[model samples]
Target: MIAIYPGSFDPITLGHIDIIERGAKLFDRVIVAVLSNPSKKPLFTVDKRIEQITECTQHIANVKVDSFVGLTVEYAKLHHAGVLLRGLRVLSDFEKELQMAHTNKTLNHDIETVFLATTKEYSFLSSSIVKEIAQFGGTIDHLVSENVAQDMYSKYQNQ
Candidate 1:
């Protein structure tokens, strides 16, 4: 079945990649849909975020990268995706994700929300954490892909 893995993916952390890779294996197609939110100032533009996700997920044959600018359920419907795939790292994530799933269900009863438990190693990894480390000149090579690390470094170097 087609599943949409929707997120801001500001820089596509390894945690995100882990979810995408695993989701790709479970679904016939896993679209890594980037949410285009103008209100939040993201380090990378929507186009750049899409490119980063594409680069990181290139090895996963069933993964596709795209951007959307509306409710995630709407995006899933527009793309004919039957599932909304999400990753759960901890109880806090569960609380928030569960709420979103319920909200999406209310918006579209036909679509299902599937949650995957994150790998132990990446339980604490997140895009915000990765960006925080890079912003402080800390090593983020272990938190994200090499390409993403370089991109983060390049973006922060000018600041």
Candidate 2:
């Protein structure tokens, strides 16, 4: 079944890639969707996020990259994705993701939200954390891919 893995993906981290890779194995097709959230200012644009995710996931034939600006469930419905793949790294993530799953369920009952526990190595990883580290001149080589690390470093180069 087709699955939609939606997120802001603002400078997608290895943790996000890990979830996408794992999700790709579970679904017939996995769409890595970058959410264009206007409310919060993101370091990278939606298109940039899509490009990064595409570059990182090119090895996975079943994985496709896209961007969205509306409700996630609606996006899943548009793509006919039966599952909404989410990654949980900790207890707080569970609570937040569970709430979103319930909200999405109300929006579209046909789509199911599947939660995957993040790999142990990425349990403490996140895009924000990576950005934070890179912003303060800390090395983020371990949290993001080489290309992503370069991109992130460039963003904070003048600081």
Candidate 3:
């Protein structure tokens, strides 16, 4: 029942929302886990990303958004989640996800990773791309939730 949807979610885009909505429909509970990594230059902080995801998914009864700062498998274990959910927008995501799935399986044999194909409409929408558009004063209203778009615009302006 409880499935963990883990991702950096630097800026939760429409693609992420699509995956969460689709995954939530199948699981009793869906945890939208925001991953934290200090190495990469992220546009938004973990707290901000969590707030965006929480705002976007608040209407979904079974979805909960939270942030994690360690191994995904460890987070899943602590959260009592037995399933790991992923979104595959294209074939390019396969190799990395496969490796991660195997590693997670090695860490927790009982936990499984389920990959869901993103809807065609959202297949081209990535958080990075949305951030680029937002940073350049381009409208990303359709690429993310209304709240996310507004937050991105405000954040970019303040920068």
Q: What is the C-alpha local distance difference test score of each model?
A: 0.93, 0.90, 0.90
Best lDDT among the predictions, by candidate number: 1
Instruction: Report the number of the highest-TM-score candidate.
Output: 1
RMSD of candidates 1 onward, in order: 0.6, 0.8, 1.0
lDDT of 3 at 127: 86
Lowest lDDT block of 10, candidate 2? 44-53
What 10-residue stretch in candidate 3 is worst by lDDT? 35-44
TM-score to native of every candidate shown: 0.98, 0.97, 0.96
Per-residue alpha-carbon lDDT of candidate 2 for residues 42-72, written as tens digits (9 for 90 to 100):
9987777788888899999999999988999
Report the error of model 3 at residue 139, Å. 0.9
lDDT of 1 by residue, 70-154 (tens): 8999999999999999999999999999999999899999999999999999999888988899999999999999998999999
Give the lDDT ranking, best first: 1, 3, 2
Q: Which stretches of candidate 2 lie over 4 Å from their true place?
A: none
Candidate 1 TM-score to native: 0.98
> Candidate 3, which segments miss by more than 4 Å at Cα?
none
Give me the runs in candidate 1 sitting further than 4 Å from their true place.
Answer: none
Per-residue lDDT of model 3, residues 57-128, tens digit only: 998999999888889989999989999999998888888899999998999998999999999998887888
